[model samples]
Target: PVPVFKSELTGLTLPANAEIIAEGFIDPNELMDEGPFGEYTGYYSGNKGKDYPKPILRVERILHRNNPTMWSTTVGKPINDIHMIQSLNRTATLWHDLETMRVPGIEGVYIPAEACGRFWAVVSVRQKYPGHSNQVGNAVIASTTGHYGVKGVIVVDHDIAADDWDRVWWALSTRFDPKRSAQIIDRGRSTPLDPGLPIEAREITSRIILDACTPFEWTNKPNEIFMNREVLQKVSDRWNDYGFDGASPVANMIDRLVKPEAIKTKKK
Candidate 1:
């Protein structure tokens, strides 16, 4: 909270321990040019689209404490200032909003810190009926928080971990169909910081809903092959006997069986 105005001689009122103060009056009708600010998108956010004037604050008084410690921050880069500062609050808000939305099949919600916690999101859903994933995608787009700034929303199956990029990417590759599984919106609220759009178009951005889930209409899912538990257990029980060091039996078993190229391929 800012200091309140108290006495003319004292300027803005300060707490007993306070040492510095500055006073400003904002006339709502007064307008000024602002920005050319370095934004969280790692690009300069300049005046874009229609030039909207900014409010002007006129400083009338200044006071100082004996010594002051200034607090400031820098931005740009994913999971950095932009991500760290806003991710928690914004994700909480999104999760709350989605909860209230009551969209069917919704199991979990996440906003990727890689998008400064605003631009991209993922929703995990346990598909209960045909078109359930699409319902989630459209509902999220029209929901309160999703109506603004969010450029992309990916709906994944409940088995996929929304917060894990590896799982998300795997689902995206195997489940997403360029011809059928995407919802493309022509426009939605955007900001000047978006670098992918033209300056004039930054006021609104194209939204995409990428559905990374199997079609719920299917009668049966492809049976996935798995390693035998007995074999895995024997390997784990003998891991130390085989001289594998620094890793537990469970870790050794995983390393023995799972390889980057050996993941289940997408069903035809």
Candidate 2:
């Protein structure tokens, strides 16, 4: 369904979906089910087949060019184009929010595409303070989208790429201890589209925070042992000379799996 834009004060309604807009606040009490419309969670949320209240967007005024395109995004599964946009947004917003909280040694953040831009986040930060990984995980749980479908939040050291699940998993395998490094919060509030929620209320769900960062208490040895960056870079620069391709080994593996011929052979 299309949304009709109208001015409450002037009673001026747009000819159609006009491009220009003005913003104003409205009473929450005045809200109706604005949607069972398509939501980013790949579901028709709100009162469609079920009784639910949707948030209302009250228009205060109207202004626009002769012809303007309305910015709209499709909501569906992970591969949908809009999911890509949301992924970028989640990464930026979560990164900024954690940085603002003064969590030290944050190198990068990535919200995986498979999580539909909301369900999971992977953070790469330098391990400094003991229990710092848990602190970062809790902060993420309190963030906007992070409070939603986020079933898991994995924290890794700066050496691992936040976007790479394999590396993240490796970090978890080597660094995380199930007893001391993982936390589960029951009855947490998550987005309504989360399939894990047994009730319709947005305030009820559960989540796990995994501290994949290396244990700081292991002071008997160095936390990380790796080639120096300058040396690594020099090796990387001449990698081709050593008969190795510069392309990612992971990407090459994915290519083999997704190749059309491979699919046909598997089907046969």
Candidate 3:
């Protein structure tokens, strides 16, 4: 027979096992080696060999449906299904935070897959103020959702796609100056999965704010570049009819004039 206990939060008595004895009390000061359990980071570290204090989770009661099925997840590489879900969550949360800031020329937000969904974020915003990119970077780090796992937050001009690594690198190479474009934060609670931290101590992580915006020193730049969508649509409609097969004639002509080889290959 199973005994039941009433929960303070749920206000219900839950069926609990009496004989399958595991006993522990919540001690704010006490710490023990809790797990060598498999973690989402795809590494196992716990009370086995390492001398690290583990926070205790007190289990008050247990409930079971007759013959319940246990479900579990494994985390490792970037392409994992769990990582994809986290990436989507990060994108939505980051986008919402940026929109709340009302930054000018804001285009889109994306957290790339390679960054493990939480360690890094890229934001695309219009450069309105002298240090707009830096402002965005700081705001991203300060955001409640952003505060968790992010070690770097990069802000780029609207011209750069937040999701495209190549374009992001190009912007960094051309627009960023190490002295002017970088901001470093010395201390924050680090992600536990980050192997850089020593197993015995709480990890402190540094955040890098990369301002990938164009130089504000250029006064002749327009505040906004408007695209004539109607004209663009017309060009797209007539692209195949024009001598440019499966390509935009205007784009092809521009490429041909600037660098002829760029237009030689058809886009797959």
Candidate 4:
């Protein structure tokens, strides 16, 4: 039971923190098509088909704060406010939903803003078995956040960071074998605003789960070379002595990490 606020103009009862109050409801017996708006996909979707009789809201009156700074943003482009807002919100939802579902080995989840947080989601896992990745993927696919719109999910070993697209691609290329690692489901709920969907079939979609990890079945796998922690810490402590204006290894690590062949991995 959430607290409610009664709007003076429309007499609409809304959640206490709701910024705006409107009198709107839909009768399942009635339907109307709406949209063709600039969707978050960075394209115009849902505008091509016939107008379905979707729910229409009749705003009797509107009420807001005295000096409310209306938060708004444009779609059809990545790295904008819309994507940023969706990324934070959708990522939180995905994380929480995964936790609520009790999915094992759930290390991290990241829904990148550049994709509008709908098309692609990345999950990091400490896989316990060969099907652990699939289990995690299935749980995510069935979760509330993943039950709709998300077309692709990539599950990577816990060593990889979900937000690091560069490493995600690296894992995909090195760890994923198309014939063996791909999982496809024929049908699922689709994003209404997906331009890639046939105008008539935008309501349903298929999903792809790419298991971007070295299969647990293998006994011997190539070891990933990483910077020595002790050396890294020593370098961090002596960062000022190396004549850098800032006492951080970011400037030193960025290029070296990107171009690993440029530097020799220190051996014990």
TM-score of each: 0.79, 0.66, 0.64, 0.75
- Candidate 4 lDDT over 93-112, as tens digits, reads 99999999988888889888
lDDT of each: 0.77, 0.73, 0.71, 0.79
- Give one digit per residue, the lDDT tens place, for model 1 in 1-268: 7644465753546564456556678889988777777777777776742277788778777766677755566776676866866767777787788778877667788887788888988999999999989988887778888888899999999876678688789888988898899888987888667888887767788899999999989779755444754567677777788888755557444423453234343122
Q: Which candidate has the highest lDDT of all?
A: 4
In model 3, the clashing pairs are: 105-126
Give the higher-TM-score candidate: 1 or 2: 1
lDDT of 3 by residue, 98-157 (tens): 788675666878877667677889999877767777778888888876887788987888
Task: State the local distance difference test value for candidate 2.
Answer: 0.73
Ranking by TM-score: 1, 4, 2, 3
Summarize candidate 2's per-residue lDDT along 1-268 as a digit string, tens digits: 6667666665656445657776555677864754556777776565432555545667665567678667777788676878888889989999988878787888889987778887888998887877777788888888765776677888887767799788788878888889988899887666666654543566577788888887766768444443333444455566677788765343334322243454466579
Error of 3 at 110 (Å): 1.6
lDDT score, candidate 2, position 14? 44
> Which candidate number would show the highest TM-score if scored against the true structure?
1
Instruction: Go through the candidates in order and give the C-alpha RMSD of each one to the true structure.
Output: 6.0, 10.6, 8.5, 5.6
Q: For model 3, how big is the CA root-mean-square deviation?
A: 8.5
Q: Give per-residue lDDT, candidate 3, residue 128.
A: 76
How much is the lDDT of residue 130 in candidate 1? 90
**In model 3, which runs have C-alpha deviations exceeding 4 angstroms?**
1-32, 46-70, 220-268
